[model samples]
Target: MSRRRLPELTHHGDRLPAQEERERVDMLDGRVGVEERACRGLLDGRLGASVFLVRSPGVVDGRGELVACTPEACSRWVRAAAEYVIVVNDVSAELEAAHRRAASVPWWRYVAAQRAFRDWKTIARRYEEVTREAAEAYEPVAREIGRALAEMVEIAAQERARQQDETRRHRSVLAARAFWGWSEVTEAGRRAVYVFRHDVPRDDAPEGAAPEESPHVDLRGLRRAIVDLDLPDVRWDGAALAETERELAGIGFGRWWRDLFHEDFRTFTAPPPARGSSSGRSSPSGGTATGGTGGFSGGFSCGGGF
Candidate 1:
């Protein structure tokens, strides 16, 4: 038996004709509306997130008919800038299905997942630029999928923290009201008192100023009430309360006032500094932590890995 040499694969420039490029671009444009619908479907779980290639670049034989070709040549063209060919069947239908499915999940969960998807897009774009090799396109896609998963988990964790914070704040507010006979006041006045106590001041006061002088309510009776109320176990030390008030004031009293007093206020707890990675995982203890693989999800998807 004699060994045989395989035919050389043509580069994208040679294989994909201008006419084909125009046709593919036109097809893609036509499919844009459907593609968007399909993407939404996948995000909403109405349609599974899977990549499919309906047509790949190829050539016609002398008989003037298209013919199947080897994967090697297809791979070459893909590397050489061949446009991805795909079809999104029933995108609108799928989106409707997804909308129905999404109704079962908590609205916040859906919103969190969407945010993660956005982050993943941003990270994907950067990954694509860094890894320009033809074989690496799938890597970025996989990374994006991973980011979406991680984001879901992170959102859940952050939600828990927020809930805890809200519980603590609620109790503290109740205690303050009880101790000061604040319930006797009108609802508006009671709210004002709570806002005055909880709202951190933004003036350039000395760092160690007394609580009363610091423009934040630091009544010992209020603190005792917060502890006695038997709220969820939150790390509500004097320092943390002060910091929270300061952060709230920095943003503006009116804007964050409602947020501070919201029933689910605890669910919006900020992640500790240690868990500040793009992946949404935090360090075991509270200290500086390095960025995790820069992955994101939701509307943030882009060209790179992080």
Candidate 2:
């Protein structure tokens, strides 16, 4: 897909006189905020460190979304530009030293030194041109670049908030699916308890939630509800789970129903029994579908293939 473009930062108008353009550029420069100032300083080899490194800004994700950049990533960009400046300076110094020492050197040595100087001059000139071009490009649009970045950040924050809200609203539905997907029967004081994995906490979970209390919803009730619907023949197995998930999607539940194993929504009910258990049956291994494939089924069950 074609990457979405950011707002154009270049000016558009009748060409101004050189003096007027210089004045205009200076006025725009004055409008640069702290982050922009730091960025400019870094480009000019002024600041050793700045908040721009911490801010990290972000990049467009091709779909017009702003993806947050890591500090490490931001540092790489700064480092590349800084290294270019250092290279140019170092090469210029080496070339100057070579010229000064040429008169005292042997003929062959002077020839080799002159050849090396030519290469260094080209390298230094190229790096210097790049640095100058970068500064020139940034100077005119510094204010606009800063404004656009701030807007992008705000948009990203709002997008995150919207997503969090959507997740919060659908958490109950996710919990239900998670129970159906991962819950298993376990012994708890001679009673058959439905163990639902509840390890992953919500982003907006209550502060100081009961640490000892495990989150659960008795899915046995859901099983009973299915039976009460007079669908007693429905075997809640892997096939049934697959069909139910498909139906949920068909009815506008979207892709959320398929997120049973997603880390954010999944639970760890309990560990499975060893291959051979007291009942003399092997626990299901892998996701190979077994049992009779005849007739229709629905709901969930800890028995058979799943």
Q: Estimate each model's TM-score.
A: 0.19, 0.30
List per-candidate RMSD values in Å: 25.8, 17.8
Give Cα distance to truth, residue 44, candidate 1, Å: 21
Best by lDDT: 2
Q: Each prediction's Cα lDDT score? A: 0.30, 0.33
Model 1, C-alpha of 199: deviation from truth (Å)? 15
- The global Cα lDDT (0 to 1) of model 1 is 0.30
Residues 214-264 of candidate 2: C-alpha lDDT, one tens digit per residue: 334334444333333332123223343344334443321212322332211
Deviation from native of the Cα of residue 75 in model 1, angstroms: 20
Error of 2 at 247 (Å): 6.1
lDDT of 1 by residue, 216-284 (tens): 333344333433433332112223334444433333221232343321111123322433445332223
True-vs-predicted CA distance for residue 306, candidate 2, Å:
22
